[model samples]
Target: MGKTIAEKILSNHSGRDTKAGDIVIADLDFMIGQDGTSGVAIDSFRKMEAKKVADPSKIAIIIDHSSPSPNEGVSAIHKKIREFCLEQGVKLYDVGCGVCHQITPEQGLVVPGNLVIGADSHTCTYGAINVFSTGIGSTDLAAGMISGKLWFKVPETMKVNFNGQLPNGVYSKDLVLAFIGQIGADGATYLALEIGGQAINEMSVDARFTISNMAIECGAKAGLMEADNKVMEWVITHSKKKPNPQVADKDAAYKQVVEIDVTKLEPQIAKPHTVDNVCGVTEVAGTPVQQGFIGTCTNGRLEDFQVAAKILRGKKVKDSCRLIIAPASKDILMAMIKDGTYQSLLESGALAVTPGCGPCVGTHNGVPSDGENVISTANRNFLGRMGNRNAFIYLGSPATVAASMIEGQITDPRKYL
Candidate 1:
């Protein structure tokens, strides 16, 4: 009868003994909204006759999608968000501040054992640091904004153990893709994924974030990682709040258990139209590509850029291909510049966009033309994911994207390593 991490966190928030299938009204540590959704949330807030946010400090409004005012319509949304945040005394991250998923963690707005909700589906990204974060619709976002509380049905945990060292050029992205491909898109519906084991324990925080960021792709409620020293150190450095970390008890039960050995795992790719339509890199080798994108909430961290820079150094992007680089945040972009990662990528014919969602949301920035193929590090390959339903999207790791940018096709990343 031991409680999993999710149960323990919910119990703490709700002041009740909680478990899977139980519904609870819990206090939230943080709530977030982005330009794409915040305007609607603001409208909902006003419609509810809510005068003030329960806690302005805990609520954040970020303008990332359609950033820099892609068009007049989006510009009005940006203006509305800015005015709402300013009037409510809420924190606002304007254009170029980075994606909400990346900046929330970067700014230490989330911490271990915290219950968080955002209007964006990738809010599960915070689970890399052991926070119980999930996505909600704009209406739910407004409710949390006004009350600082939300209801939840505690989710059963799914334990995924990753052992063995990841081979060079094969990354956490590949490992997660392989898992998603195995489980299919709806496999973990409404389940909290607890990812751990030797490989995950050894991965850098940035890489771990990539895995958690895509948990939603498999229909997971949230992706949780153990708050080991590495995660603790990250939270300590980034977060001002004292950590209240939690780990699942040894006897805690899981709805399912999956084991993956990464010693020989290869670079994975998710073919167009679905994230779970995946295959080994060799399965689709030599597939022509017109774009190679290496940024998004999923893989726009500093580590991803370093890998891309290393691969593109002393080489050039294919003449027929366009390589687009986007850093996850202004901080990551600055770090890349200090270390020459930015320069390396640019010299190799890669075009650097603002440190935001870029073409991943299909708003502006780097959309591809009709009938083109794009190898990207972003999660999701659903039709029109990159702005055009006619263009195909292939999901891969940063190294895989970089390697493919050179060859103008789907090439194995190990070839560059």
Candidate 2:
């Protein structure tokens, strides 16, 4: 049987010629840690009595979720990880360098066809450009750090065959949210998703990133898109060279297949508390919003900001709302400044936040107060995922967020698009 791109990558990294159903310990190329559980992971390794890391340089320690420190426990955890990374010669990216996953790709770490594991579930986001990436528990990640090998269950692959043009205001987030909602949260558990077809070709790298980033949330092992010239070009523009790109073979089999036609879609929203609890924005028209955010590892890239900036330029946010923009990386931040997108957003009254995962993980600046409602482009609307449970969160694309900020209500972006 022909192997999918994900299967091929896994086989190559297994240090053996792997076959389906063959269990192997795969060598890891890169690993990442965040503020949440990385501290415990490092501590657990420390308790192992002089266990040395396989390669410290390949480890990336990031302080994002606890950016400004949500509380005493999280703040201390961030401090411990920072000190441990510094002491162990592990590369660290503190707040202001932007979300770890977003900056990791931009910083030239998440190349294609590599097995990159992280402590956070969203680590699967790196699969967008053909890398076979996923998240593991702290203990597993710590073990991988020392041994440079990780284990997988060899998930069955599912092919998503999307066809037709996406309607205006129906961006990548919309397609993915709809797909996962229809499939249910646990539908793809322990499975690899092979995304392809005309719709995948139309979506940009950032948009693809958005889709792959949320795959893990649906319990999928990883959501992968075949790498083509578009991905190759983005790789060239962002880095010196590209790694091997992989795609599923013509006769490769999938566990299941789904076809999505985005031609007549509208802006959709994942209501508070659950990503799968989705509905068209029109269904929530009277829903009021007090804040709008347009940045995250998922949607904080330069392209995402440009879309929001275009809509908000020469316009003003309503009095009831506070708009915030935090680019995904320092490189993206610099580009937006160079292109004057920053100024346009500022002129339109959006608050310029640091180049970090601000508010995305409910850590640093932009926390919403009780009874406040937030419309954000960040992934996940889980309770307390954005700071406080008392505050409500609505997840949408950048267009809907910016449009809502202008209208101060849950208005569909298609009206403006």
RMSD of 2: 1.7
Question: TM-scores of all models?
Answer: 0.99, 0.95
Residue 371, model 2, lDDT: 88
Candidates in order: C-alpha RMSD to true structure:
0.7, 1.7
Report model 1's TM-score to 2 decimal places.
0.99
Q: lDDT per residue, candidate 1, 98-181, as tens digits? A: 989999999999999999999999999999999999999999999998889999999999999999998888999999999999
Q: Model 2: runs farther than 4 Å from truth?
A: 17-21, 68-75, 240-242
Model 1, position 184, has a per-residue lDDT of 90
Task: Residues 317-368, candidate 2: write the lDDT tens digits.
Answer: 9999999988877788899999999899999989987877888777667889
